[model samples]
Structure formats: C-alpha cells, structure tokens
Target: MKDFSTEITYKTSRSSGAGGQNVNKVETAVTAIWNVMESAMFTFDEKLRISEKLKNRINSEGLLQMTSSESRTQLANKKIVTEKMLELVEQALFIPKKRFKTKPSRGQVQKRLDNKKKLSDKKENRKFKF
Candidate 1:
C-alpha cells in the first residue's frame, strides 16, 4: 500500500450503534479525509485518474472522506478508516486489462445452432397435434 498518512486528517465522533453507555461517552467513530488535489504522493495523471474513478466519494471540495464506527476504541476505528481510505485509493488507481473482441469459430457457431435446433425440435414434439 502507498504511504498516504501524510495526506490524511482524521476526525473523531461518538459512535451511534451498539455498546451501551460506552457509546455515549466515547468518540470511537473516525473519519479520514484526504484532498486529492493537494496530495503530493500522486502525479497529475494519477490525481486525475483517482478523481474520475472516485468521484462519488470525493466532495465538491475534492476531499475524499471515509468513516468507520464498527470498533469500540478510537484507535481501532481510526485504523479501520485509514485502511478503508487506502483501499479506495488503490482501487481508484488500478487499470484493468483491455478486452480483445474475437469472433466465434465455425465449430462454435455450428454447435450453438445445433443446440438451438435440438431445443426447437423437442419443443415442437411436445405440442399436441390434432
């Protein structure tokens, strides 16, 4: 994974889900925010790639934010949120292999036609003739 720690800023809030009274007193929910435009880790092209791929996650301010509140401890939540952000960025930067389009061979086309004809024959036989 890339070292994005320098570009991230975290905010903590009280978690909303389970955990009894501990939930009320502790700020275990963490939100990690990173500005794609301001990041030094990625080049201009990489920044553009991330912006395009992760456009939904990034706000109008160009900040990519991820939140995690599953853990009870603030530190644990922070780690989870950071990991989530890293995963998102990594996915955004990934380039899939291009697909090569190819036509089916004569044997394949003939096999498919044969299968269709067999099905049609079976269906035709199932019909009740007067």
Candidate 2:
C-alpha cells in the first residue's frame, strides 16, 4: 500500500474478549488511528477520496480508527491493526472500472420471446374447456 506509516498512531487497551485472568492483566488490544486531515503523505484528492470512502470509520476529528484484539500481545495487535489500516486505505483509494452499457444481443432477445411464446401455448392448452 501507499507508505503512510508516519501518519499512524497506536493506542493499547485491555482486550475485552475471552482470556480469563490475562484479560485483566494485559493491555493486548490495539487501536490504530490515522489523522487524514493532518496527513502529509496524502494529497488533497487522495485525502478526499479516503474521507469519502471511509466516512463511517472516521470520527468528527477526521481520525480514521481501527482496532485489533485477536492477539495476546500488544505488539502483535499493533501489527495487525496497522496492516488492517493499510488495507482499508488501499481499498478506499481504489477506483472501480466503469461499466459499459450494452443492449441484449438479437439472438438473446429472440430466445426470450420464443420461451415466452412456448409458455403461453402451454398455459392456453391447460385452460379448462367451456
């Protein structure tokens, strides 16, 4: 992904899931925050793209935040959060190819009409005689 490592900041907190006694003792969960508005690594257009694409994840302060709690160690959780943030940014920056509109082929249209006619004939044959 685009190098935005300098723009990221990490915070650790106690993981909330299953870990028994370790959950209370260790701060394993990591939150990665990226300040999109203050990022020097992104251009105005790039920042706009990210902000628009990831609006749900961004807070009022323009910080994009992600969390990881799968790992037992803070360092592992930090790595996972950072990777996830990068993946999210890369996905936001991607522009999908435009769809080219096209009409159905003559053969396809004719096939559909034929099937409709067959169904109509079958239904008519099944009608009760007067």
For every candidate, C-alpha RMSD to the true structure in Å:
2.3, 1.7
**What's the lDDT for residue 86 in model 2?**
90
- lDDT tens readout by residue for model 2, 1-130: 6889777998889999878999999899999999998988889999999999999999999999999999888898998889889999999999999999999999999999999999999999999998
**Which prediction has the highest TM-score against the true structure?**
2
Off by over 4 Å in 1: 116-130
lDDT of each: 0.92, 0.92
Off by over 4 Å in 2: 128-130
Report the Cα lDDT for residue 41, model 2. 84
lDDT of 1 by residue, 23-100 (tens): 989888999999999999999999999999999889999999889999888998998888888888998899999999
Among all windows of 10 consecutive residues in model 2, the one with the lowest summed lDDT is: 1-10
Candidate 2 scores a C-alpha RMSD against the true structure in Å of 1.7
